[model samples]
Every structure is written in structure tokens, then in C-alpha cells.
Target: MSDASAVTVAVLDDLRQESEELDLLVAGADAARWAGPTPAEGWTVAHQIAHLHWTDRVALIAVTEPDAFAAEVEKALAHPGTFVDEAAGELVALLPPGELLTRWREGRDRLRAALGAAPPGVKFPWYGPPMSVASMATARLMETWAHGQDVADALGVTRTPTARLRHVARIGVRARGYAYLVRGMQAPEEEFRVELDTPDGGTVAFGPEDAPQRVTGPLLDFCLLVTQRAHRDDLAVRAVGPDADRWLDIAQAFAGPAGPGRAPKRGAAGRGDAE
Candidate 1:
């Protein structure tokens, strides 16, 4: 492989690490735990894994069969608001615990292989827009990390925050306007700066240095905020201006309709460490 391919493959390595982390979380769980409820309302641990597996399968089709992927997109468009949830429920109910785990692992392997072989500059069609190879990998990593957080929460396990969160943070910073756009509001013209303190005591900065609007916080909290896994009120994230504050309220790093963010956890959850 070329040096460029090597670099891209290294970026994809994060996906493998994330998958392994999740595997370790679920690998030894008994059936009762697998069927237990997660932070996502009405979704059990099995449902989370099933959704990941199904999305991975659909993403593979997008990479390998463009026409078939377009047809699926059309089906999604036909039923606007409820498609994603309905689809997840249907797929989750179809599998036993062992089958679900096997399907998820198989789909993840196939997705990694297909993405590794895709041409460097080709864009894959997706629900919102096309994504370049690197963007796709980053998106996949973000999904794995976000969903994994839910599983970890349900299992009462604490996950170590890592530098890999930079990718998700970057996506969050970039999606500031997307958050507004999806909600049918025009994104503000002024750029907003984002500065995050990394787990290793380093910093990752985005946007203009001189912008009047800014957000500053721990990187893990920023990731959770953007993923809608934590309420804005629960995070240490500070916004300097009105627009920045609005973005924090509705920030979404992932594609799709505006997510109904997690309801504020009633007690200590509102004040606890985000990661």
C-alpha cells in the first residue's frame, strides 16, 4: 500500500480499538444483562448492538452497491420521522443474544475491510450527504464511542476517556451549523471558537482564534454534549455568546434529524463527571 493508504489505515485503526472496547464490555455479559435497559429509553443492550450491526450492514451496502443504497435511501425518505427507530426495533427483535453478537462482529469486520479498500477520493452516499473515506471512518468511530457510552452507563462501568475523543470533538465543532440547519434555523454567520482540554493535558482547538463566540470545556464533556448523550445543563462546557449557547443546546456531531437529547438525569447525574 502507498504511504497515503498507510496513513488512512492508521486512522481506521481507531475503529478497531473502539470495537474491541465494546466487545470487552459485552463479551461476558449474561443474557439478563444483555436484555437489560440502557440509557436510551426503551432500548436494551441488545438493541444497541443490533442497531450498530444494522447500520454497519447498511453502510457496507452503500460502499459496495450504490444503486441498492439509493433505493434504501428512497425508502427512508418515504417515511420521514420514524424510520430509524422503527427499523432498529424491527432488527433488534429478530435476533437472539448470540446471533446479535455474531452479526455485529461479522458486519464490523466487513465494514472495516470495505472501507480500507475504497479509493481515497471517492465519496460514499449517506443519509444526509456524501462522505469521503476519512470522514466515514471518523463518523464510524464517533458512533461506536457514543453508543458504547450508553452501554457502559447501563452496565455501571466507567470508561477511561482517551485521545481518540479528538476525532469526535472535531466533528462536534464542525457540526455547529448543522445543528442549527437541522432545526430549520439559519446558522449564524460569525464563526465560533472551540477549545477543549484533552485527557493527556494537551489541547485541541477549532474555529477562528478571534471569533466573538466561543466554547471552552473538557473534551469528554464536549463529545457527550455534541452526541446528545448528556444534557447541556449537565456539562462544564461554557459558551461565550448567544449563538454559541444555542449551539451547545442542540449540538449534533452525527447526521440525521435533530436528536431528542437525553432527558436530564434527576439527581447527582446532573452534576457528576461527564466521562
Candidate 2:
């Protein structure tokens, strides 16, 4: 395995740990709370967890049996994006909240082990292309952290980013290309110099010494803002250079076209406007 591959594994480890943290945070909530509104629009935290567990199952299936991916996506797409809009409300309405959490915990653990033990060199077919197991793992982390933040926010809790968030930061950096393309601009070929503050009150920086594009902030802040899991005003990321500034304004870690992008103003009202 190469360095890049190791990064994915590290991200997987982060997901595993974060999954446990999320489980603890959401434990023992009432059905109504489960049904309570989350920042993720229609879906509640329960729905988000279900989706994460679902992806683990689907991704593993794609790895173990590559031939079935296309057909599976057809079935998977039946639920729409993350299936929260489809099943979470129903799950919250029908099942006991405890049961739902129990199911999600079991599913999350199973998927964790499955990915860890996934057959080597497997490239799970995704919307983009067949991604190596490592990429799949990173995707899992990104999803877990992004969605978990939703739950944390709903509960008025602050979830800090671990050192492992370097992976998420990296994805946000690379996805600048996608952001640019979505806006009908040629993808910038220049690399980004990313800097994130760590959980231990330290800063993490990446890329070349003189990289023109740079992202600097706390890892949690950067991860949350870039994933669109949270608004930019919540974080204090400083981006320099014209291209870097625009990309940061719209950097999306997920696979998709750019939606409306908001530049973080120094002072805006509300929690989202916090600098």
C-alpha cells in the first residue's frame, strides 16, 4: 500500500471512532426528537445514520461482487439522496427510537469490519468510477463526519475534529476542481496549501511551500464548512489569491455540481454567521 492508501485507512479509523461518538450523542432520544428537524432538511439524525450504514453495506457489496454495482445503484437510487427523504421519517414514525439506534449501531459496526476486511485491491463502483477501497473508506469518513455534525448541531453540541480530519481537508482541497467545473470554469491545475487547526490546539498544514492556493483554519471548521455540512460563517478559514478564494467559497467535498455559494462575511447575524 502507498501513502495515499494509508490516508484512506486513517480516515476509516476516524469514521469508526466518530461513529461511536455519534451513537453516544444520539443515544436514548425520544421518537419525537428523532423526528425533530435537523439541519439536513427533511432527514433527522436517525435517518442520517441509516444512510451511512446503508452505504457501507452497498459499498462492500460492490467490492465483493463487482458485477452487481450498476444494478445495485438502480435499487439504491430508489431511495433518493441518502434515502433520508424517503425512509428516515417513516422509520422515526414507525419504529421505536431505541430500536432504530440499535439497528444503526449494529449496521455501522458491521460495515466498519466489512470495509476493514474488504478483499484487497477492490475498487467499488461509485458515481464517479471504481474507487479503491481506500477512497471508499475516506468517503465513509466524510459522510459520517458531515452527517454527524448535523446531529450535533441539532442537539446544540459542538463536535471537534480529530487529527484524522486531514483526510477530509484533503478531499475538500481536491474537490476545488469539481467546484470550478460546476461553475463552467476550467479546473485550476495548481495545488492547494491547506492548513487546519487540530483538536489538541495545533495547526495542520499541507501542500508545497509556495502553493498559490491555500486554505487555513481549524480542521473541524474547515471540514464542516467545505462539506457544506455547515455554513462558512461558523468557521474562520482564510483563503488567499483570486482562484483560491472563489474555490474556497464554493468548495464541496461531495460529488456534485456547485449549489449557491456564500462568501463568509466578517460579521453576519445568527450562528451560521459566526466568525
Candidate 3:
């Protein structure tokens, strides 16, 4: 296989692993547990899985049928805010916990298969922009991990950080410009240097060594920030330049309008302000 093909396969594998990990967390959940609230306001544990299932089905359509995917995009455009929540809420209301879990598993399996079989160099439609197979896989992995964090938190379980977080961190770094653009601000012309300490103690650096703007912190913390899973005040991530600092306030890895990030935990040291 070519290098690009190999990388795509690797990302697909990671996406599968990430999904399975979250699956294990919810596979045996009871109704009460499924109804448990997560960090995302008004989103239950079941809602998290339901949202993933709905998105996976949508993504499958995007990969398999572009014409149909256009319709899905139109629905999103028609009700950008309520569309996602409505889908998940409907799923939770219609399906029992076990059935919801089963459907989510099945849908994700189909999505993985569709993505794996897609032709090379073909970009698929998405809520924001078109994405290659690899980009789609990485985005899936990122969402899986982010939502998985919610499930883990609701269950009062602390998951061990894994190298899979590299995918999430990479997206966070690449979405720097999108973060600004979504907030109606222009992205800085000069790239910012980002150095994140990986889970295993090594560092993964992005951008140039001599870049004027810099962000440095734990890879997991950065991922949490971009995904809006944790309040920035609870994280150790620090930015050096003015733009870099502002970027942290509004950073988001996912598409759509800017998210209402989690508020700082009570009594937590405030890390300035975030939007």
C-alpha cells in the first residue's frame, strides 16, 4: 500500500479501537446509568452514545451517497442548534438501553467498513467542509474519545490516558484557525508553535521552532480544551503569545457554532477567562 493508504488504515484501526473502548463502558449499562447526566449540559450518557450513532449513520451516508448527504446537510442548516440534540433525544426516547447500544455498535461497524472501502483521494462531505477518508477517520476517533470522556465521567470512572490521544491533539492543533474563524475573528497569519507533552513523557511538537506564538502543555489537557470537555481553568495548558492566548479561549475541534464550554469547577484556580 502507498503511504497515504497505510496511514488511512492505521487511523481506521485507531477509530475502531476508540469506539470499542467506549462501547465497553456502556455495553452493560442499565436504564438508570444510561440516564445519568454527563458533563455536557442536558446530555445523558445515552444521549452521548445516541449522538455518536446518529453521526456515524450520517457519515456513512456521506461516504456512500453524496446526493443523500446533501439532504442531511440541509437539515443541519435548517436547524443548526437543535438538529443534533433532537436526533439524540429521539433515539433515546425510542430505543431501550440495550437496543440503543446495539444500534450504535452496528452503525459504527457499518461506518468503519464504508470508510475503509472508500476510493483513494476521494473527499467526503461533512458539516464544515469536505474531508478525506483519513481525515474522516481521525475526526471519528476524536469524537469517540471526546464523548467517551463524558461516559467515563458519568460512570465515575477514571480512564487511563492512551497514545490514541495523539489523534485528538493533532486535530486540536490543526483547528486553531477554525477556532478563530468561528468566533468571528481572523486567524493570525503566522503559525503558532505547539509543544505538548505526550502521555508517555515524550513531546509532540507542531508548527515551526521559531514561531512567535507558542502553546505548551499536556497533550491530554489540550485535547480536553479543544473538545470542550473540561474547563480551561482546570487544565494546565498555557499560551505564550496574545493570539495564542486568545485561541485557547475559543478553541474547538468539532464543526459548527462555538460551543458553550464547561464552567470552571468550584474553587478551582481560575486560568484567566475563556469563552
Candidate 4:
């Protein structure tokens, strides 16, 4: 296989693994469990899965039917804030837990197939911007992991951190500028160095070593912070310099308006050990 193709396959495999992990969590859930409230205010466990199903279906359209995807974009533009929630709510109301689970599984399988078959160098249109197939897979994985966190939290489950988080962390790092842009702020001109302690006790570093701004912390904490799944204050992430500190406060890996990030846990200390 070509170098790029190999990379794509790896990402897609990771995406599948991430989705399957989440599936295992909810596959046997009873209706009461599916209706349990999650951290994403007003969204239940069922809503989280429905949202993933809705997004994957739309993403498949973007990959295989560009013109049709434009209509989806138009719908999003018309509603902006409520469109996502509305779709998820409709799915939840229309389908019972069992049907929802089956549909979500089918949608994910179709999306994986479509993305895998996409031509190299082709970019698929999205709500934010076009994305390459590999990037699309990574974004899906990040969302799955983030939403899965909510499910895990509701179910009182603790998932072991894994290397798959590297994909989510990478997206978190890459979306630094988008985080700023969405908030009507310009990103710092200078690159920032980020060093995350991986689950295996190694490090995954990004950007230049000599960069003036830096963020350092556990990879899982960084991923949680960027995905807005955990409040910065509750995470171990540390930032140096004003820009990096600001980035941590506003960082979001998902494409959308700035999310109302999770509130600091009751009695939790303030923003990580930033200097």
C-alpha cells in the first residue's frame, strides 16, 4: 500500500475500534439506562448515541453525495444552534433503545465503508470546512471518545486510557486556531509546543521545542479538556505563557460554535497549574 493509504487504514481502524468500544458500553443498555441523563445538559445517554448516528449519516452523505450534503449544510445554517439537538431528539423520539442501537451500528458501518473507499486527495465538505478522509475519520473518533466519556460518566464507569486517545489529542492540537477563530479571537502568531504524557509513560510532542508558548500534561487530560468533556480546572493540563493559557480555556476539538465547557467540579481548584 502507498504511504498515505497506509495512514488512512490505520486511522480508520482506530475509528472503528473507538466506535466499537462505545458500542460495548451501550449495546445491552435497558431503556431506563438509555434515558439516564448525561453531562451534556438536557441530553440523555440515548441522545448521545443518536447524535453520533445522525452525524455519521450526514458524514456519509458528505462523502458519497456532495450535492445532497449541501442541503444538509443549508439546514444546519438555517438553524445553527438547534439543528444538531433537534436531529438527535427526533431520533430518540422515533426509535426505541433497541432500534436506535441497531441504526447507530448500521450508520457507523456505512460511514466506515464510504470513508474507506474515498479517493486519495479527495476532500469532503463539512459544516466547518472540507476534510480529507483520514481527517474525517479522526474527527469521528474524537467525537466518539468525547461522547463516550459522557456515557461512561452517566453509567459510573471508568474507561482505561489508551493510545487511541492520541488521535483525539492530535485533533485537539490542530484545532487550536479554530478554537480561537470561533470565539472571534485571532490565534497567536507564534507556534506553541505541547508535550503530553502518554498512557504508556512516553511523550507525544507537537510544534517546535523552542516555541514561546507551551502546554504540558497527561494526554488523557489534554484530550478531555479539548473535547470539553472535563473542565480545565479539573484536569492536570498546565500552560505557560498567556496565549497558551488562553488556548486551554477556549480549546475545543469539535467543529461548531464555542461549546459551553463543563463547569469545574464542586470544590475543584482553579485552572490547571498554569504559569
Which ranges in model 4 have alpha carbons more than 4 Å from their true place? 266-270
Query: Residue 37 in model 2: shift from native, Å?
Result: 1.0
* Better by TM-score, candidate 4 or 2: 4
Model 2 / residue 180 / CA error / Å: 3.4
For candidate 4, lDDT tens digit of each residue in 32-137? 9999999999999999999999999999999999889999988988998899999999999999999999999999999999999999999999987689999999
lDDT order of candidates, top first: 4, 3, 1, 2
Candidate 4 weakest ten by summed lDDT: 266-275
Quote the positional error of residue 255 for candidate 4 in Å: 0.5
Q: Which candidate has the highest lDDT of all?
A: 4
Could you tell me how far off, in angstroms, the CA of residue 115 lies in candidate 2 after the best superposition? 1.8
**Candidate 2 Cα lDDT to native:** 0.69
Per-model TM-score, in order, reads 0.93, 0.81, 0.96, 0.98
lDDT: the better of candidates 3 and 4: 4
Error of 3 at 69 (Å): 0.9
For model 1, the superposed segments whose C-alpha errors exceed 4 Å read 1-7, 266-275
Question: Residue 50 in model 3: shift from native, Å?
Answer: 0.2
Clashing pairs in 3: none
TM-score winner: 4
TM-score of candidate 4 versus the correct structure, residues matched by position: 0.98
1-275: candidate 3 lDDT, tens digit per residue: 99999999999999999999999899877889999999888999999999999999999999999879999989988997889999999999999889989999999999999999999999998887689999999999999999999999999989999888988988888888888877888999999898999978899899999998888889989999999999888888888888888888889999878899998885446574322
